[model samples]
Target chain A: MEFLNASVIPYFNYWIYVVLMMIGLHAMITKNNLIKKLIGMSIFQTAIILFYVSIGVKTGSTIPILEHHHDEGHAETAHAVAESGDHHAEETDHEKSDHGNNEHAIEADHGIDPDHFANPLPHVLMLTAIVVGVSTLGVALAISQSIYKDFGSLEENEILAKIKQGGPGVDV
Target chain B: MIVPFDIIILIFLVITALISLRVRDLLGATMILGVYSFLICLLWAEMGAVDVAFTEAAVGAGVSTVFMIATIYHTRRHSSD
Candidate 1:
């Protein structure tokens, strides 16, 4: 809690994540070897995923679980406070309730309304990315294996050489 | 808090990148790259991107490392030198 009072620093972490993402992407783009490039691509993609998940986190907030029965007492007190207050206070509490309802709607649309707490969008997207990455890896490995078997070497140059030497009919 | 944590993560990331580049042994480089992914994952979590961190932790640190090492074994293990 003490550190929370310090200057706004939460945004700095995101900046570093972006920088790392760019560096990894640069490597993926410039690297020559196929496998090295794939590694770079993984790094690049992962940096962004990290960025997405981090955005959903809220300080001091636990997982969004509704304590409906427990919250009843608190809500009753809040209602009492509103009833005793002047019109402005009553209007303010009404506004707060509306805002809460709006948030609940958004959470429902996303189908991740777990106590109205975490942002579920990022989790859903990450799940998709994980599946896609694995599929891509499988395909890449299959291709690499086929290349090695055909050329008797993994280097791109060696494969080209074997292809040239065979004059186009030799298949490994 | 964010500033210092970010700076530290950045330094580790740079070191990992340099090592991955300068190291001649591909296997060693791939291992270092795995470490790089892990550090970056922490950075992401710090940024409030829990979902992203989860994926990075799983795919980047777990699957990708295995993929790289398996490829290296298939290609380079057979080589005598």
Candidate 2:
């Protein structure tokens, strides 16, 4: 009860993701069909990606587009913040309440609070992961098609049995 | 983010994931998987991962579903277990 009340409420996102990951793993392990296995693999991959993306979530923080102030004090604040790194740490939450304020061009990171923006690194990395997952799905599906063509079945046990038979067409 | 909204979407996501895996027809499962991907993308977008959501919508939900369907057309759709 204490665990549910205290820990689970705050971190329910992580908990649900863990449940999803387990579901994917179970499907991957117990499913018999080749396409089902691939679907499970995709589920597992997406769950992992979602977990990583959730890591970057900061409560009340806007998207990580640091809108430059473009005022006279901008350069001064940038230089001053660079000199005193500890100050920017405390003000990230209050300063970053807006999202569509990207009129100005790119500026130095010293002026804004780092915590004001959700971490971009994880999202970026997951983009690559998504690409790899899609490519892997395509290739694995193609290979499964080939497997079906060879053995005339997509069930794992049947494929194994056919391979064990060592027929003339059993190149696999 | 709104906590209740996030919770709702996450719950829906888990349900969709489970259904997709449990469905016997490969094509139906793939379609449910696409629904799962779209839910995740919506979650990402609401949580401020816009670019990540965009990519997921494009790759995970759109192209991957088509890929699975194309493969299904060539292979068998029913699963024994």
Candidate 3:
């Protein structure tokens, strides 16, 4: 019960994806029509996308864009470090150039906080997936159209029957 | 853990999916599938995946539905099974 409350309850969105995936799977398996199967495939694909997107969500967080205020904070810290380094440079004038380079690196590091931004890796990957899915759907629809043109039906068994008879339409 | 709005949207998604599968009319199934995609789009946006939601709305709801409808127009809309 403790594990359920801690782990399972917090990830309710994943449960929604699981249910959706099962429904899509059932449709893909049981449906006879090609178009229906395509619909099922789309649903399945979207469910998987949802699952991935949900994994990236953080509570009370905004989008991945770094705000101007964070940038200002980084600049202020960098400026303070440079001021302190200038005092040290009076004691050791040889390292002044190196300290300037280090200041730039520190500023870059402080410019963004990982926890403040949503995970962008998943978003980039899913964008490719969405394009691929659209292309696959297009090709599948084209094939189904050709099958209908040749076999005169989109039902799998009917197409098989037509193929078994070695109909003239099968040649095309 | 449970957001009432998300739960409501998920329920609608499940209902649309079931209806799409069970409906005998191919066109009706396609339309229901469009509805399913739109709902998922909203859900993803709510989950802070605006990029994914945008893509899904365009591909799943917009182009895919149009392609399926065009294919249905070319092919037989009724399944003989």
Highest lDDT, which number?
A: 2
Model 2's DockQ score: 0.82
Ranking the candidates on lDDT from highest down gives 2, 3, 1
Error of 2 at B4 (Å): 1.1
| Model 3 lDDT at residue A6 | 85
lDDT for every model?
0.60, 0.80, 0.73
Fnat, model 2, is 0.76
- Which order, best to worst by DockQ? 2, 3, 1
Name model 1 segments beyond 4 Å from true.
Answer: A1-14, A57-118, A165-172, B1-3, B47-55, B77-81
DockQ winner between 1 and 2, please give it: 2
**Can you write out model 2's per-residue Cα lDDT over B1-81, one digit (the tens) per residue?**
567899999999999988998899988999999999999999999887888899999999999999999999999989886
**Taking the tens digit of each residue's C-alpha lDDT, what string does model 2 give over A1-172?**
9988899877878988898888888888888898988888998998899888888787886676546644445433223334343434444443334421221112233455655666666778899999999999999999999999988999999988988889655675
Minimum summed lDDT over a 10-residue window in model 1 chain B is located at B72-81
Total residue pair clashes for candidate 3: 0
Per-residue lDDT tens digits of candidate 3, residues B6-80?
778888998998888888788888899999989988887776677778988998799988998899889878764
Docking class of 3: medium
For model 3, what TM-score is found for chain B?
A: 0.92
Better-scoring candidate (DockQ), 1 or 3: 3
Candidate that would win on TM-score? 2
Candidate 1 chain A, run of 10 with poorest lDDT:
A75-84
TM-score of predicted structure 1, chain A: 0.57
Candidate 1: C-alpha lDDT = 0.60
